[model samples]
Structure formats: structure tokens, C-alpha cells
Target: MDLDPRTGNWRGIHSAPRDGSLIWVMDPNCGAFVMRWDDEETNPMFSDATGMWVASDGSMTWCEDTDAGPTWWKPCAQ
Candidate 1:
């Protein structure tokens, strides 16, 4: 995945896996942030529904409720 430093947007070079597992990377060449879902975890912070996403750089973000849905990504509080 590649993260745009200017927009905080990302795109994956390859399609993400279908399995319910999470992936994270900290390499500069691949950008400093990466996250995927894992369904087996019981913690809300790890749940695909209400998980807290933390980048390798220590930045965090999470989903928020909206008319569109719970897919809106909001920056975590410092």
C-alpha cells in the first residue's frame, strides 16, 4: 500500500486479501501506515466493526457513524 503524505490517502498496488486477517507495515518505501481487518479478535479495538487503527508511525484513526455509514475514518484524539 502507498500512503499519500499530502492527503493521508492510500492505495494498494495489489488487491487486499479476502481472509479476515490484518496486515501492518512500517517501511518508508511502502509508506509508514498500513492496516487490514481481522475478524477473530474479541477486543473492540481489534474488531473489524469498531477497531482503532494505528499506523506504524503511532498515528491512529477510527470509524465514525454517519448517514453514509460507519466507514468514515476520523483521526484519533491526541
Candidate 2:
């Protein structure tokens, strides 16, 4: 909220992500329960995507091909 003391003006305000602020990179091939060893960040959560590339920041992204096109998804809700 913003207000002008001298002129008695006021305005209400709110802000949110235009395209959503959350992005979760989940390996598409992982099932509900699986365990694997990773060479990147220690103790990093791993999924079974058949193939995955984890950057130094521990962010993971993968891609798969389909008849229509490439589909992408973030596994995490937040």
C-alpha cells in the first residue's frame, strides 16, 4: 500500500510472479523410490531420468522427445 500524506492520496498494491516463481527440475525417469550415487553436490536428491545433467548450482534439467514436441516439467511444487 502507498499513500500520500499531504494530498490524501492512496493506492492498494499487490505483486506476484507473472509466470509463477517456482521451478522444480525432476528427472522424468525416477519412480517414487529409487537410490543412486551422484558426483555433483553431496546429498543431492536424485531421480531416475535415464539421463540428467546437474549443474554446479545443483539445478537439474533434462529433455525428452515425443511425437508432438519436447515437454518440460519441474518436479518440485515449491
Candidate 3:
């Protein structure tokens, strides 16, 4: 398990996929995040607030209950 970059807590994991991407496994507390880590930095897989997903692509997704979903998200200036 690796430390969540957002919370500095060692309660997350990063799995290398067969597609060469990444799958971040956060803890149960939903207080941290993990993203596709290639270099030394691990991108926090959070759009605005607490949430849970075995994957991430910058879209609103539901992995489990609604109460544990993201509480904040803003449209990127794209």
C-alpha cells in the first residue's frame, strides 16, 4: 500500500493495469486518494472532495453509495 498524496496517509494502493494505465485503491475512510502514478508523484484522484472509484477519468462516477461520493467538483476551464 502507498500513501495518499492528498492526505499524506499510507492507506492507498496503486495497481498497474495491463493497458499500461493505473488503478488506484483508496482506503475505507475515503479521506485520501491515489491516481496514475508513474514518476515519484501520485496524483490525488479527487475532483473536489471525498469519493471512491477503482478508476478515474475526470468524470462523475458512482462506485458505491451516494453518501460517499464527491462533494465538490468544478468544470475545468476547458
Highest TM-score against the true fold, candidate: 1
Error of 2 at 54 (Å): 1.3
lDDT of 1 by residue, 30-68 (tens): 234344433332345535455333333435542322222
Prediction-by-prediction clash tally: 0, 3, 0
Span of ten consecutive residues with least summed lDDT in model 3: 69-78
Candidate lDDT (C-alpha), each = 0.34, 0.27, 0.35
Cα lDDT of model 3 by residue, 49-69, tens digit: 333343345443333324563
Q: TM per model?
A: 0.24, 0.18, 0.23
Q: Can you write out model 2's per-residue Cα lDDT over 1-78, one digit (the tens) per residue?
A: 112323323111112111323333222234111112133323223343333333324444322222221222322323
lDDT-based ranking, best first? 3, 1, 2
What is candidate 3's TM-score against the reference?
A: 0.23
Candidate 2 lDDT for residue 53: 31
